[model samples]
Structures are given as C-alpha cells and as structure tokens.
Target: MADELKRRLVHASGSGLVALYLLADYLAIGLTWQYFRYLMIVLSVGVIVLEILRLRVGLEWWLYEKLTREYEQDQFAGYGYYMLSMTAVVLVFRPEIALPAMLMLALGDPISGAVSDDSLKRVKGPKVLVTMFVVSAALAAPFLSHAPLAILAAALGATVADGVTIRIREFVVDDNLTIPIYAAVLAWLVLEFVPI
Candidate 1:
C-alpha cells in the first residue's frame, strides 16, 4: 500500500509540467511554448534511451524496483508510456487542449487508481468510472469552461481511457499513454465541430 501510494504520488507529480507551462507563460519567464515543447521532446527521448537500457541492457535503478509493477519487469514501464503520451499531447495539440488533457491524466488517473479495486480482477466498476469522469471534468473545467461540450468530451475520453484496461499479447496498454491523448483528441474534436 505504501508503495502504491508512492507510485501514485509520483504519477500525480506529472501535473508539474502543465503547471510549469502556465507559470512560464503567466510570468513571461522565457520558457515559452517553443522551449517547453523542445523540453518535452528531449525528455521523451531521454526516457526512451533509459527504457532501452533498462529493458534490453539490464540497467537498473532504485525507483525501478520501487515503482514498477510485476508486469513491467520485462516490458516498457508506465513511466515510459507517460512520457510518450505527454510528449504526444504537447506536440500535437494546442496548449488550450493539451494542458487540461495532461491534467486529467496526472490528477484524474491517480485519483481513480486510488479508489479502484484490483482484487476483483476486472475493469473498474461504475463508481470508479464516475469518479474518473468527475475528477477529469473538474480538472478541465477551468481551462475549457468556455466550451461545455469540449469539457464533457474531455471528461468522457479520460474516463473511458482510464477505466478500460487492455492487453495485447504480453503487453498491457497503459492509461498513462492513452488518457491524455484520447482526452485531448476528443476535446479538440468537440472544439472543432458540434457548432459550439
């Protein structure tokens, strides 16, 4: 339980990226979107390199033992997926869509994870799904209040992504890589269409 809490805490800390972007833009700290974008790219690349070393070259880290799951011992860890998804959203979406999307993954997913019951060995139940939607919607509300449709779309996307766990052969498709990307895409679609 303590380890799970630590992992979730680390997962939630990913929100710092969005917060950093906001502070940088608000304070005119010269860490504009251009620099932030490059930073994400660089960080993603670094993560890929580290993942390769960890998975292929037998490299090990202290956090790897503490934070990784039983399934991650032989595959890409959630951290890699997280960086990939975050980088994807930052690179592909506008900040208006990307920041809230990232926030949903960072805050919403962890909150849902905390309330989930893996002992059932099933997808999250309705209550967990509802919690995910609520947290995601609240997170996006501040940024997307202007577009209620977009806000709902984003919340639904995040809830679905986080609630449904899929596996391909031996590899589990992680919500860390799906939640933000799906949420951002849905939000962008609503912003583009729906006659808002």
Candidate 2:
C-alpha cells in the first residue's frame, strides 16, 4: 500500500509538471506572448516555492494521494486517455489548443467525476453519459473553435472510452494505453480531413 501510494504520487507529479508547462504557455499566449520573460520569471519562482512547500510539508504527496483516491478505476482510465489524446492533438496542429484543452482534461474531468458520482447516485449508462456530455460541452464551449461540435464529440469520446475501458480491463490490456492513442489518432484524422 505504501509503495502504491508512492507510485501514484510520482505519476501525479509527472502529470502536474506537464500541466505546469501547458498552463504557463496558455497564460503567455492569452497575454499575446508579450512579457513572457517576466511571466516566466514569476511562474518559475512560484513553482520553486511550491516545490519547496511540497518537500517541507508533503503537500505534493497529499494532494496526489487525494486525487488518486477520488478516482475510480474507470475514471483513471478515462483521464489517462484524455491526457494522451490532448497531448497528441496539440503536438500536431493548433499547439495553442493544447494548453487549454490539456489543462481542462487534467482538472475538469476529475471534478466532474466526483460531482457526477454523487449527483447521479444509482444512475448508470446513458443517463450518466448525457450528464457528462452536457457538463463537458458547457466547459469546453468557450475554449474550442467549433465549440458545439468539438464539445459533443469529446464528451461522447470520453463516455465511450470510460465505459469500454471499465468493461474490458479484466479481459484485455490496460485501456490507459490504448484509448488515448486512439483518441489522438482520431483527432489527427479529423484535423487532416477538415477544411481548416
């Protein structure tokens, strides 16, 4: 159990580092990339402070542990897929999209997972799907280009990705590796096909 906890902390920290980079880029872009040098200085200092706090107070492990605990197996699979997908799409085109989308993917899904679990107590299937769809659509709308379509597709993709991974994890390989790669590929294909 201790080892598992330690492992989860390391994993969460890796995700957090990625998120930090993405967030810094997002802030810089939102600020039109001007004064990025100053922004970087401020953010770097902040990160160092946070890192010191984490070491001195165990803040990093505590937060990661809580996040890992709140996440169900299905939620973990879903989140893993979401990150991998967003990473790939952003790597190819519209790198700007990555910072916002990946940040949301990292933060939003977990929040929704916890909230939806309680809100829908005993509910299952398409009902849960619709709830996530609506929430994701609303959250994603203001951030993406084709707001409605992108949100709907992403929500649906998340739904299917979670449901399938939950059902198949026992009989097959980990969905964490498969789902995100597929999603990224799908996003890439869409980008290629779209007129843009």
TM-score for each model: 0.95, 0.45
Error of 2 at 113 (Å): 1.5
RMSD of each: 1.4, 9.2
Give residue 195's lDDT in candidate 1 (0 to 100): 82
**Ten consecutive residues with minimal summed lDDT in candidate 2?**
72-81
Best by lDDT: 1
C-alpha displacement of 174 in model 1, angstroms?
0.8
Give the Cα error of residue 79 in candidate 1, in Å. 0.5
Query: What number of clashing residue pairs does each candidate have, in the order they appear?
Result: 0, 0
Question: Roughly what TM-score does model 2 have, to 2 decimal places?
Answer: 0.45
Q: What is the lDDT of residue 82 in candidate 1?
A: 93
Candidate 1 lDDT, 42-122, residue by residue in tens: 999999999999989999988899999888898899999999999999999988899999998888988998888854334
Q: Write the per-residue lDDT of candidate 2 for residues 37-91, one digit (tens) a residue.
A: 3443454455556555544665555544444433432233323433445445444
